[model samples]
Each structure stands twice: as structure tokens, then as C-alpha cells.
Target: MTGRPPKRQRIEPRFHDGESGSLDMRLTAEDRPAAGQRPNAPRKAKPANRQNASSGSRSGPARRKSAKSRRGKGGRKRRGGNSRLLRFVKRGAYWSAVLGIWGIVVVAGVLGYYAAHLPPTSEWAVPKRPPNIRIVSASGHLIANRGDTGGEAVRLEQLPHYLPEAVMAIEDRRFRSHFGIDPIGLARAVFVNASSGRLVQGGSTLTQQLAKNLFLEPDRTFSRKMQEVVLSLWLEQKFSKDEILEMYLNRVYLGAGAYGVDAAARRYFGKSARLVTLNEAAILAGLLKAPSRYAPTNNPKLSEERAQTVLLAMHDAGYIDDDQVKVALAETATIVANRQTSSENYVADWVMELLPGYVGSIDTDVIVDTTIDLDLQHAAERSLRTALASEGGKLAVSQGAVVTLDGSGAVKALIGGANYARSQYNRAIHARRQPGSAFKPFVYLAAVEQGLTPETIRVDEPVRIGNWAPQNYTRKYRGPVTLTEALSLSLNTVAARLAQEVGPARVIDTAQRLGISSPLQKNASIALGTSEVTPLEIAAAFVPFSNGGYGVVPHVIRSIRTMKGKLLYSRKGDGPGRVIDPYSLGAMNRMMAETLSTGTGRAAELEGRPAAGKTGTSQDFRDGWFIGYTGQLTTAVWIGNDDNSPTKRATGGSLPARIWKDVMVAGHDGLPVSALPGIYEAPVQVAEPAGSGLVPPGRIGDDPGRPILPEPGKGRGPLNLLQRIFGG
Candidate 1:
């Protein structure tokens, strides 16, 4: 026991039966009379029986002899009474010895239990583990539990009176009015054991049960019983009756994968503990003994029978009236297991996988306030489903992910995969597919940095950068095209020449500054998205252009709060150093705006908002991509089969663009209209390329915050420091 008392005596013995002999046949000092009185000064005559008649006849025949014998008989009779008393005393001594040993064992066991488990007053026996429950949202009304991230917690004083009464009736009738131990009930249990010829029966009170559940060993044993009594007494002394009752209700197991009454309440009735009816409470109470076998979720018939037993107990305990019993008997428990069916199924696995990454570990009751806008998440899902339906062919897809962020780099909505269950291959955060033509903007940014404007001339005709012949998507070159037209039309040949002109090294440097972590090859085809990249990398890379050419990293967790509601840590938005000149960033935005306005993304034109976006259709259409953003929000969409096979007739504009538009429309429903945070001016006046039809350039914005140029040897700093430590 954690803190229970030793042992208790049920019945106090009154007297000892230790006498020597029969009263009539023994002599005693009392029969000799007092010192001043005569030794046999005539004993008081007693009412005589049949034996007395014979005495009278014998006295007459031998009057003298009889008188003498009678004189001696009084003393003998007195001694006889003393002897009988002595014998009774001896027998009483034997009984006392047996009772003493029994009492000592009981008391010793109780004391040992009390000493061992006396300190802990709470539910110390439960496994010390991180809670697995993840509530999607916050409940406004209740104080949350320790495991409750956003859910409710019920307190002791708030318990409905009927809840405890039902529990008391179902678990242990004599809960109160005991000093943490119930001797009478134990005796009765002993009788029951004797009748059944087994010791499975017990008389552990509710307090004892609570004590056992909270702190002591679970093994059914006399020693455990002693410990339970000790712990129960200690708990009773420490906590109030109501508090103990509440703990019992909230901590008791109720089967169906539910722990406390609150979880059970939600699982069965699709509601909170406060709303459960008396009948519902009774049904739950019935599950106290053998929760699995009697659970309403598993066996309704047996559960009803058990509930009736609880009701009858309650009626006997005078807790309910006749009508209530009748009604309870007639009612059936309608328990729907896991009321939130399929809700947790879709997000649980993804959320769990991310839990550790967000907090650097997942073994705490850390509250993760995600930027997931449930509304946009729903819309993204709906639009994708609609597009899939239009295809009329089931896509051989294992997973899908979407990441939508506001213009300020705040992730608005995200779904890691369609079902985070079948496989937790979070494509939104993990998969690295080639960006195809989607990477052209970085090439444009590189060109602008090297004194090249959007209208800078480049040939879209067949071009050979070394051995690779970069051609247009149609394989037929468009001859000469301005940079603006090339970007909009996604002409591959023009982009390849621009990268070659900027020198492959500078282009690679620019991609790195834009927060693309994957290695980029120093080849001409790099402009055509030959390198692999994740969607998150693309979103994060675009954040710089969105935020006036300042690099910003993407992060999900804002702050971590402990299970006890203490703040542990937070993620501040400090990323890798600034990249891209504001002037170049603005020029790229202008070109992308044109791309959306009248080019490949002409399908993306909204009602009145000015938007900029790009479309990417890789070779064989293995991956379809659309990276788009308004002045307010930025969203990127990619759709393809996971097997890297062609999505039949699917283009970035076909389905991905539509999904992107739908997601952005829902995600940007609120907020103000602000200009994109970039330079107001354009590049310094430059000669327009032939057939470009470009607008005249304004003065260039301040040439500050250029992409951090890679050091001569990829920084011999931290990487070198670790290398030195290991001498590797």
C-alpha cells in the first residue's frame, strides 16, 4: 500500500473463559467467609431441585452425619465454583492467543503497506507516458486535462450527484463511514469465500479500490489488500470525498479504448460528461467491474443487464425512486464507439509524424498550433476530388499534399497527404520531384541580377548548351523571343541560353540563395528544372520574392506548451541570409505577372485581382506543377501519379491550376489589399530587345540584400569544425 493503515479488529472480545473445574465440586477462599465471620457461618439457602428431595430424606436417616457432611459440602461447592471459573479462564486464554497472532499479522501487514505507499496521494500507479490523444480544436468551456491539448477536463466539485451515487452502488456499497478499511464487509466476504470454497471474492471498499488503482500492486493478494487499506486511508485523509470521487470517475477504465469518463462520454454518447443522463451514467457505472466484457461498445445485451444490476443497487441504496428504476430497466444504452468516426483517420498519422519534428521530439503534451486552415484544407481536398472525377480514370496515387501560404509567408492551409494512414509518405514535406519549367523564375532572377531585364532578348530556337539540345515544348522552335515572352510561353530553348549566358555557376549560386537545399547541377538544363526539389522547398524559395527579396524559411510550429500549460519554446522566423536584389525580384514579379495575365496561366485570371503565377509540364507529363501567388497569398500545386508515370492529358493548367485557384480563393477570403513587398521602381532604362514590345524601364531600386554568394570552398566553418572533431 502507498499509505493505508495496518489492521483492524471487527469484534472486541468481552471476556476470557479460563476456569479450573465444576463450580459445585470445588472449594474457594470466598466459601470460607470473611476473617471476622465464621468459616462456615451458614451459606445462603438456594432454591432446590429433584436432587434436593433426596438430600432431605438422607438427612433424616443420618441426621448427625448429614449435618456434618452438609457443613463440609458448602466449602466444597464454593471451591467447585472457583475451579469452573479457572477452566473457563484457561479456554479464554487459548482463544486470546489465537486472536492476538491474527491481529498482529493484520496490523503488521497494514503498517508495512502504510509505510511503503504513504507519500503519494495521487494516481501514481498509472504508466508515465506521453498522451496519444490529439484534439483538432479547443473547447471553450472546460479546464483541460493533463493529456488534453485542446479538450475538456472535469473537476471533482462539478460532478453530478448521481454519478458518484451510481459509482458507489456499482463498485462498493460501503464507501464512506470507514477509516479506510471495512472489517464487516471483509468478514462477510470471508463467509462468501467459505461458501464458494475460494478466495476470489473480496470486500475492498471504493476507497480501497481507488487506492489500489492509484498506487498499489494489481495482484490480488492478502498483502495487496493490506496495502490498499493503508493507501486508501492516507488518500482519504489527504483528499476530500468529492475529489476522490471525481478522480475515480475520470481515471477509471471504461473499455473501448477510452480512459476517463470524459473520453468514454465522447465515445459512447458523442458528448461530454456533463450531458450524460442518469441512465447513461448508470450504464457507465456498470462497466466498473470487467469493463471489457460489460462494455456497451462490445456487448449491449450484457451491458444492459449489468446496468440493471447497478440500478437495482442504487435503488437498494435509496439513491433512486421506483419510477426511475422502471425507466432504467426499460431503456437500452445507445453507445456509438468512437463518435468522431474517420475524422482522426485522415490526419492522425501525418500529425504524429510531424509531432517529433516540430518539437525536436514528441514525448510531451505539447500544443501544436498549426497554420492549417481547415476551410482551405477542405476546399483543396474537394477541388482535387472533382478533378479526379473529371479524369474518369482512377489515378494510381498513394498520397497527395498541398501547401498554401499567405503572401507574408504564413502557411495558411496544408494537407500532407490524402490519407495519412495507408502510408505516411508526407509528399508535401518529403517528395523531391523535378520542377521542370517551374524553375524558370530563378533563372530570370539570375539574369536580372546580371544586368538583364525581363524584355532581354534570347533566341527560343533550337539551342545547344554543350551536348544537350534545349528545345521548346513543341520541339519546333519559336525562333527569337524576348525574355518576357519566353517565360510566359515556358519556352525551354530561351531559358537554357539565359542560364548559359549568366554562367552556370552564378545560376547555381542564385538557386541556393533562394533556399533550394537540393544540389543543382552546373549544366544548361538546370534552367529547365532537371534538379529534384520538394514542394516545400519551392514554397520557401518563393517566400523571398514574396517578401521583397528577403529569404524566409517555412516553419509549422509557432510555440510549444507543456502538458501543464507552461511554455517551453517557440520558433522565430530567422532563416538563411538575404538573397535576390529587390530590383531583380520586382522585375521577375512583373514578368510572372505577365505570364499569368496573357500567357500560359491565362486560365488563372481572377475577377479583378492582379496575380502572378507559372505553369510547369515536365517531359512526358510525369509531374504537373503550378506555382502561383497573388499580392496577398502564395500557393503551389503539383499533381501526378506517385510512380512518376504520365498523368493522362494532365497539365499544370488542367487540374493543378484549378486546385491552386480554389485553395487560394478560400484561403484569401479575409484581409486587406496590400502591394507586394518589393521595389516600387523597375530596372534602369535599357534598350528593349527586337519584337519584345516592352514598356520603358523606371530607375532601379536600391541594390541591397543580394543572395549570399557561396564562399570560395562551401564554408570551412561548422562543417569543417565537425570534420576536425572526428578527424574524418
Candidate 2:
């Protein structure tokens, strides 16, 4: 028995038969009849045995309960899983919101703290740059740019388009598109710094960099960074975009102590901003990154590599074409090796030192028109450095100086030392060293004024005064030597004798009158240059001999004027009048000329050009000097040590003479050769002192084949100065 096959019936919504002819009805799934069964058909089933029926009914109830239990368990498992997923999502969202709010609060606090330290933006104004001195050579060559800026401020429009473009490409690619601070760059920097765990990159926009340079200190703190941001925003609001860029290019530090693009160009490439080429522009643009580290002047090879990177960046930025990039990469850029310590600065310093005296005080930018021949100045520096490099080690010479002056006493060139950077002590004008035999000319001039001819024979034997006995450099003496010969050979005893006869006072007077401004000791030892004097002093003193007995003040700056050409100080023809008399001038020139021709200064001779000079070696070679003069130029060169140590048997005739020759040859390149003033030869018979004491007065030796002295015994009447000094 199928247990009545579970009674199946069909139920449909029924309407009353009298209501309508058609019945509206719908059959539902629960009301539908079972498969293969008619409505109410289940009532026909009958049970056979009571036990089997009971068993079948019991089994059906059990299976239904088990299925219900399984359904309940599956439903509870699904509900639990849904609850866990919902809790996880809700917790994650809660924490994410809390962290985001916390991050906002922290950023706001930091920004506020830095903002409090910044000054009010309303009170901001661009500070004025320090005044700069533009120094130019006598021939209008820019010798150097002086003062803090190191060069004149150049306008943005004055620069090459590629120059600013190059800087923008490398320093800030989105400079124009962004506001004062570049959000994109800052975000990128944040990401990079976060990954690196350090502040390795500063994503400063061009406007931000200008703000820092103009108004903020270079501290790498967040406070400084915030201040820079504030200032950059202010700058953007206060000025136009191009104006901001102008100020930026004019204020950026481009290494080598150069404050701006113009200064960097002048300081490094030795040019103006407008003249910067593609390669040079690339190199200068590269300097914005760790300026000194990548400075072309300091590290050329490394700078080239950096420049290549800049060129690639510029090309990538579309500021330059591929061909331009190739050209810049292939070409080389020249840079000034040292701008601060350059020899040109030495000259500029010297000129500046005198500026205060000439114009009282420099409170504004001024143009100094100097007499410095930049070419000759370079030659002087080269000669000094070359000499030091080649021989300074062996000769124990640590320093040297060179000063060249024109016939009118204008300083042509002046080098203070071997390396201006190593030592700024201007040895040329500040070092007071004994001139040794270079001083003999003054003593000889005194003797000649007192009427002793250059041809007068003097004993070269050892001479003593008090406890001092001056000996020859060779420690050997010729029995009889003419006064001319003695001065030529730098004979110490003869110089001492001449100094004694003329009296030390007369020698000092003569020297002071000529141009020796240094104090001279009034002792007999003055004959051998015991008095300390500067190379400039000695060089100026020799000017009288070259310029026909006229004194010189040794001026450097010819005129100082404003940039608009307003004269501040113009040097007039001012100097001490003629110091040496005509007769003595002729005699002195003859003797000194002999020294250059065949004596100690023979090494300093100019080819076919009449030259006269003196060689000076202080006692034990403490100083070596060669002060020589052409018809046009007079130069003095000194080589020694700062401590006054003796040289390695180095004499004035060795290094100083060679340097003088090298300098003068270049100095007289285009000048016509001329004869030395008052140089002449005279024929005379000297009555031997041992045979008859009668002598020819006013007759010096034959030098340059001229008669340099007046007629004998015809000394302006009866027993003039010459007749009295030497018996006629």
C-alpha cells in the first residue's frame, strides 16, 4: 500500500454559476494535481496490514525531519559567513577614514607652524643687490668684475633665448604651467623621498628657488621650505611670470661665487650672458645642481658629463632639437679655471685698494678705467708662474712679483705673487725688500752729481766703515776698475766707496727725489741696498732714467667714472718735477746702459732695442731683482721667499732678468725702437794717478758710443762740482 499516495487535489478560484456564463479562475502550483492523478483521486487507496502501514508512515516522518535539519544547518552557515564579511568591510572603512583625517590634521599643523615663522606677505619687497664695480683695461678689455655680484646685472631680454630655455628645461620644466609651487613635482618628490626614507630631492620650482635666494636662508628645514613656498606664492602674485623668471635668472647662485647668469657667464666662460653658446649654456645650466660640485671651472670632465645630461633633458623637453643637442654634446665649453684666485683679481684688488683713496669712498657702482694692459698682465702672471713652476723648487723661491710701467709711469701690469689665490700679499707693492745692487744706481747718481765721472778708476779692494766691511759678490777684486765697470759688474766695494765719497745723505736725497718713497737708512751700508724698498718704488725710480730725468708717481687707475660716463676721478699730469740734472742724467744713463750691455743685467737685453737696467741681489741672495727699462717701458721683477730665506745661489741675473726680458719683448711688440735719453760716448785720456795725478774731469766710459759727460775742467767756470771731486 502506497499509504494513499498522499492525497492530491486541484483547487481553483470558483465563481458562482449563476454570476456569469464564464468562470474566472487561476491554478496555483500548490493547488495543482499530482502527476498522473485526477482531483481527489487519493481517497481510493487502501492499506493491507496495520504493521506495514505503521512502519511506512514512521520512515517518511524520519526522512522529512533529517532533510529539515540539513536545510537549517546550511542556512545558519550562510548567515554566519555574511555576518563576518560585513564586519570586516565596516572595520576596514572605519580605520581608513580615521587615518585620512589624522593625516590631514598633521599636515595642517605642520604647515601652520611653518607659516607662523614667515613674515607677513604684505610687507615683502625685493631687496636691492649690492653694487658692482666693472673694471676695464686701458684698451677697454674687461679685466674683471668686482664687488659681490661679480658682474653687472643683465636683463632677461638681453640673454639668449636658448639660455633661459636651457635653464628652464633643466631646472624647472613646468615652470610656466605651474603656480608658484609645482604640485606634480612636489608629489613626485614626496613619493621618491618616502621610498628612499630621506630628503634626497628638493622639488623646488623656479619661482620657489628665486624666493629662497631673494628672501630666505639656505636651511634645509621644513620651516625654510614653507617660507620659500609662501614667498614663491607672493612672488607669483606680485609679479608677472616673465618678471619672476627675470629676477630668478638674475639672482641664482651659479657657482664660482657668481651670483647670477651674467656673472656666471663672465666668471666661467669669460663672456656676457647674451654671448653664451649652446654648449656653454648647457654647461651653465648644469651648474644649478650642486653648483660647486658640477662647476665646469672646477671639474671640467665631470661638468661635461653633467652638461650632457642637461642637453638630453633640454632636448627631451622640446626646448632644443636633436641637431642642437648633438651640437652641444659634441662641442666643448671653456671655463675660467679660477675666478676668485685669478691673477686678474690680483689686479682688481690692487685697483680697489686704491679706489678708496682716489674717490674718497665707493658707495655706488663705478667703472674704473685702469691702465692695466690685460695682455701684458697675463704675460706677467704667466712669466712668474712659469718661473716658479720650473725653478721655484730648486731655487727655494716660494714667491715672486712683477710690475711693469710705461714711460709716463702708468702701471702696465702688476702680479703680486706666483699664485694670487695662495697668497694675496701684494709683493709687488707691499713687500719691502732690500734692492741690493739695484740701489747702486742712486749712489752712482749722487757721485756723478758730485762730479765724479763714470770712467774714474776706483779700487775694488775691500772697504770698511765702522764694523762693516762690504766685499765683492765673488770675494775676488780687480786692482783697478772704472766707475762704469764697477757698477756694471755689481762690485760692492766700489759702490761702498762711491757712497762714502758722496755721503749717504746725498744718496738718500737723490733716491727720494727720483721716486724711492720708502725710508732709507743713512748709513754707508745703503750703498749695497741695505734699506728696504718695494719693487714698485725701485721700478718708478728707474723711470727718471728712461724718461729723461723726470720723476713718476706710478699711477694705475687713469680715471674712474660712473656707468653713465660721469667722471669721478681723472688723473692729471701730476708728479715730482725733473729730479736729476741734465749732465748727471747723461752720465747715469751711460753707466746703467753699460750694465745692461755687458754687466750683471746683460741677460735682460732686448733685441736691437736700447735698454738700461740694474741687477740686484740682496746679501746671501735673500732677494733677486732685475729692474730694467726700455725707451718706453720700465719693469721690475723680484723673486724670493716670504720669510726672506736665501735662494739656491740664484742671482738677479738669472730668473728676474729672464722674466724681465720675456715681459719687455712682448711689451714693446708694436712700438718703434728708440735710443735711451742722455746716452752718449766721450773720448778722454786718463792721467794715471800713480804717474801724474792730473785727470780728465766730466768724462765717463764709452757706452752706446756716445759722449755722456761735459768737457773736462770746463765745469761751469773755476773748479765746478766735477773739478772739485776729481782734480783736473
Candidate 3:
């Protein structure tokens, strides 16, 4: 049957272990029988290597962790092993790993770091930017002292060579050579803080100190420390040694509201940063730790003591010779209080209020070229100080506000109040009070625009409106008068009657067009200055007349620059809306000019300069304003109580006008004349009285010229005022 192959091997499945099987093809070397004898027989399994086998699983024993390889094997590093900044922050995780592996890393990586460090950093080539600075007259009530904002910053290398030596001796000795990140200093700080349980001291490096002063918070947290360290290194790589040092020197706080060494020098010695003496530098340096506590103004004894300490430190550190230290310690100002402030800061606070929205921040080293000339500001401050001093510098309720704008509407000077620091209310720009007769020019201009000439006549008789009878400041009225005389004399009755004749709506419109941003009443009583307005608005509204009717839009920021010296903003020189006819404006200008020459604002007339302006005295003597312009400058002055209480005999021509005059004298001392543009003298023509064969009463309809009628009740106040003026 086998021979025929047909009788078929009975198909049988067998287990390989104990029975002949079809699946097992292998036979052990010695266990295999000859082919003929092993045919149809199962092969024996080979012996296993028991030494390397696991208990049951097919995988080998865990031999991946070879003793030699496992020593430093995983490649993960310790906390601060190889990071760029530090391990305290998660961002430094990668850098920390790199530093830890440095010992065994490829030569390539080590070479890379060294190569990155090797290139000489490019010089800090940031261009300087002209700072957008604002000038303001200090207010009588708010300013602690009246002084103008000016002067240039000081450079570090130019600091009396002894200056750096003194600073190093007093602050930190090893500031020059160390890299920005000082590990030893951090360790010392850590040790001290750990022992005290409270952070009592920090041995921060100069770079760290700079970091704190420039960008970081004042806290001493681990994360902050890491950021400071990394940022300081970055700064070191970015700025030149001298440039960084200079920035730090000029920006650091020196207390007493004196920000930098330059400000301190001026505050202490009435000198520029470049002209400070060795003792002055020592005194300024001593102000670093706690400027207010040791300022010479509040405590000269303490300030002198601190200065002596700094001098001794400098001498011991070899910053100054023994002889120089002795001289520095012995130096003293003849009169410290006299050195407190050269001028009052009445207008300076005004500028501060108007400046921020235009420039944003005052922390940078921006060079602001203000419209104010410091010499002029000083002159104005001097005059006010002398006048007020006679009354103990607290004339009446004791506060004043002043404003000066160039023909271009650039504020040349400002004084918001008498004591800027003690009383912080900025009366010049922020206070809104009745302008009284001062609001007449705008109403008269409206009349001129509405088909009436300056020669037009109106009865200056007393009139009642809804139980409200506004009397003249003198409680008397001129019978029939030209519009010019009414404004020049600031007659309340005539102004009210004129407001009625011109349509109060038009008066409000005229005020708005001239730069009055406050909400105006619709009632005609506005003609008598019944509505409230700010001194800033009064000053700005009059600017068009100064510019010869070629209106100038009031703007503070001429231009803005970034910290890195990029231009961010620049004024477009847009002019104010041309409201009045050229002839009408010129006629009004002549009368206002006369107001200074012979009328109420006679105080405003300078000895050598041709001046023109008006005086406004509100009810209860609560607000007083004198606004005018000269050949070179135009200024506005306001005197009032900060609490809005009535002043004792305060009037536009009294203290306020004098401040304007003083500011002008100082502000325009040497400036060339800038002739008013668009001026044209009106032809003299006799105005026909009303009710002739000419126009009769009410003949002129109450027509608001070309108004884009606002929805009912929108600015209803201005609209209502217009109705009252129309005798509604």
C-alpha cells in the first residue's frame, strides 16, 4: 500500500511534546535520528539558557539598565542644570537642561555658547526723539510752589568723575566687572533672608537694581528674581555701559518729588546737572535710599548727616581723596529754604493735567520743548510771589490760575493755583465757573455773523426773564450803546440784550465753534454768562481773535516719540473754524485792544508791548478772568476759590491780570513780534438805532442760522438759553 502512495497516510494531528507531529520541523542536533528513522517522528526541543531567562514571559530579563550606562543615563538634568536664565521659571526648563549636561555634552554645544558670547554686541544706536512736552501756568490754590519744568538730562560718564566713585563706595563697590547675573550676591541675600525669616536685605547687583528700577516689580519673589537676572543680562547685552549707567542715573528716584540727579541738583543748588559740585553730587547720592526722609528741605540736619556718611564711604573706597571728602562734608548752601524752589509751580500743575493724554508717560528720557521759556515762567512766578507776599502770599481766599498761549495756540505757560501741592485742585483747566461778561465776545460775534455789524445798537436796559433779572456788575445800565462798548466794558445788561437780539442759539453755536467743549444751555440767559464754562475754554475761545481770526485749534502734543526713538504722533496744524467775518473780528479786536489800553483790563497793557484783552467778573465775585493777547503772546488769568466760594475783592483786573502781565513780560521778553494774521479794520459807520424808518423791535426774527437741528432735548440747556434771549 505504501508503494502505491494511495492508501494515504492516515491524517493525524499530534502534539509536538509527546507525540509524532506535523508542525515540529526542528530536531535537536544530537536528538535527531536519521531521516528514514525520524520520518513521521516529532523533533526534541533544545535546552534553554536558564541564566538569562525570565520566570515565564517570552521577553528577556530587564537588562536595558546596564550598570555602566545607568549611571548618568536618562539625560534629564537637575533644576538649574543648563537653563539660560534660571530654573525658577518654567520657561527656563530647556536652558536648565543644557547647562546641567555641559560637563558631558558634545564639544559642539560648548563651542556654540562661547561663540554666541564671543561676538561684540552692537552699540546702542537709538536715535533721540523730541519729546512732546506741555507748558502750563501753575494754579494759585494747587501749587505748593511755582516753578517751571525744564532742563536737560545728565550723562553718567560726564558725572563729576568723583560721582561714580562716590556711588560705588556708598551703594555697591564691585559694579563694573561682574556679568549682569551675580550668583554670589544672590547667595548672600538668600542666607540673610533665611536667617531672618523675613526679607530684611537683598545684596542685589547693579544690574538687578537697574532691572528693578527700569521694568520689574519691587517684590523679591523667586520668579521675579529669575526674570530680573535674565533681563539684566539681556540689558547688558543691549545697552552700552555708559548709556545704561546714565539712564539709571537720570531716572532713579531721589525723593522730595525730585526724580533724578538733575532734578535734585536743581532743587538743591539752582544749577544744571552738568554744573553740580562734588558736595552737591554727594548730597544727591545720599538721597537714593530714602529721599523724602533725608531731604534737605524737610530736615537739613539729617540730610547733611547722610551726605557726610556718603563722603566717608567714598573716601574709604578711594573714590575721593581725603582732602576732597573733607571739602564735600564741609560744603553747605548759604540758604537751604531759598534753594527749595526758584519759582512757584502754579502753572506747572496745569501742564501736568493737560500733558498725559497727549504724551502718555513721563518715565522715559523724552526731551520736551515746551512753549514756556523758563526765564519767563520765573518772572511770572516772581511777580505773583511779591504781590501775594504783601498779603502774606494768601491774598483773600488765597488761590489763582493763569494761562498763556502763543499766537499759534501753544500754551507758553500756566499756573493752576497758588499752592499746587497743598491744594491739588487744578482751577485753570478743570474748574468750570461762570465767565460773566467774559462770555460776551462770542455772543457779539454771533450777532455780527447774523447780519448785524459791530456798529449795531441795542438798549442796555434791565430786562427780566422768567423771574430772573440779571443786573450789570455795577447794577446800572447805559441807555443805548454800540455792541463794541458793551463788550469792552463787559456790561452785563447790554450783553444780555445782545444775546436776545442775536438769538441765544447762535451765541451757543459761536461758543462751540470757538472751542468751548462744555455743554451749553439753550436759554438766552447765556448772554449774561449764566452757563458755566472752564477757564481753558475761555482762553481757547479767545485765541482766534489773537490770531487775527485765522483760528488756531488748541493742541498740546506737537509730536510723540517712543522710548526707542520712534515718532508716534505729530500735530497736523489744523486751524480752528473761521466763525466771524474778517472785518467783524478786526473790529472786535480793536475794542478788546482798547480794553487793555484804557478800559477794564488796563492792568494787562505792558509798558513796551501793544496789548489787547477783556476783564470778566462773575456774580458773588466767585470767578474772575482776564484774557488778552500781545504782539508776541496771548494769555488768560483766573482767580477764584477752589471751593467755589466768593473771593474777597477778587476781579479780573486785580491779581489775575497782573499774573498775565508778569507772564507776558517774562514769556515775551526777547521774542520777536508775530503779527496777527487775517486782520482788516472795519469801516466806521454810524449804527442806526432800532425802531427808525429802519428795522423795528422783533423785526429780526429769532432764526438760528443753518442749524443741524439736534433731536428734542439734546443739549436742551443751550437751546433753552436761546429761547430766553428771544424773550420767550
Q: For candidate 2, lDDT tens digit of each residue in 308-364? A: 888888889998898888788888777666666767777888888888898886666
Best by TM-score: 2
Off by over 4 Å in 1: 1-154, 158-166, 177-258, 263-368, 384-393, 470-473, 562-566, 570-578, 594-605, 618-620, 641-646, 672-728
Instruction: Please list the residue runs of candidate 3 whose C-alpha ends up more than 4 Å from where it truly belongs after superposition.
Output: 1-156, 174-253, 257-275, 288-293, 326-330, 333-364, 385-395, 561-566, 603-610, 665-728
lDDT of 1 by residue, 1-728 (tens): 59879688664433323322112322323344664787668875544532354544432224445545756767668889999999999999999999999998888776776567555545444333335334342222111122432224466556567777998886777776666677888898889999999976678777777777777768977667767776777778877776677667766777766667776776677777777778888888988888889878778888888888889999999999999899877776566644333222334444555566655654544555444556666687676656656652654333445777754455655655554434446677778888888888888877766555565567767777678987777777777666788898898888888888777787777777777888788888889998888887787787776666667676544555664777756667566545656656776777887777778887766656667788887777788788887666777787776788776656676667777777777766775555655534533333333443322122223343322221122332444423322235
Worst 10 residues of 2 by lDDT: 698-707
lDDT of each prediction vs. the true structure?
A: 0.67, 0.81, 0.62
For 1-728, candidate 3 gives per-residue lDDT tens digits of 44754565675644344332233333223353644675657666544642333454221112223322443443335423656345446656766787767744654454445435432435323333222232222221211222222333566765677666666667766667667765676687789999999986667766667776666678867556656665577678887766666766766677655556766666667665677777777778888767888788768888888888888888887777878877776778532354333333544444455556765656544423244545555565566556566652344646666666766777655555665446656666778888877788888777655545444567888887677788876778888876667777777777776677768887887788777888889887798676888776678788877765545655543554543566655667566545544545665676676677767788777876666788888788888788888655667777776677887767787777777777777777667755443333323223333433222222222222222111122232444424322225
CA lDDT of 240 in candidate 1? 76
Looking at candidate 2, what is the lDDT of residue 495?
Answer: 91
TM accuracy, model 2:
0.77
On lDDT, the stronger of 1 and 3 is 1
Which scores better on lDDT, 1 or 2?
2
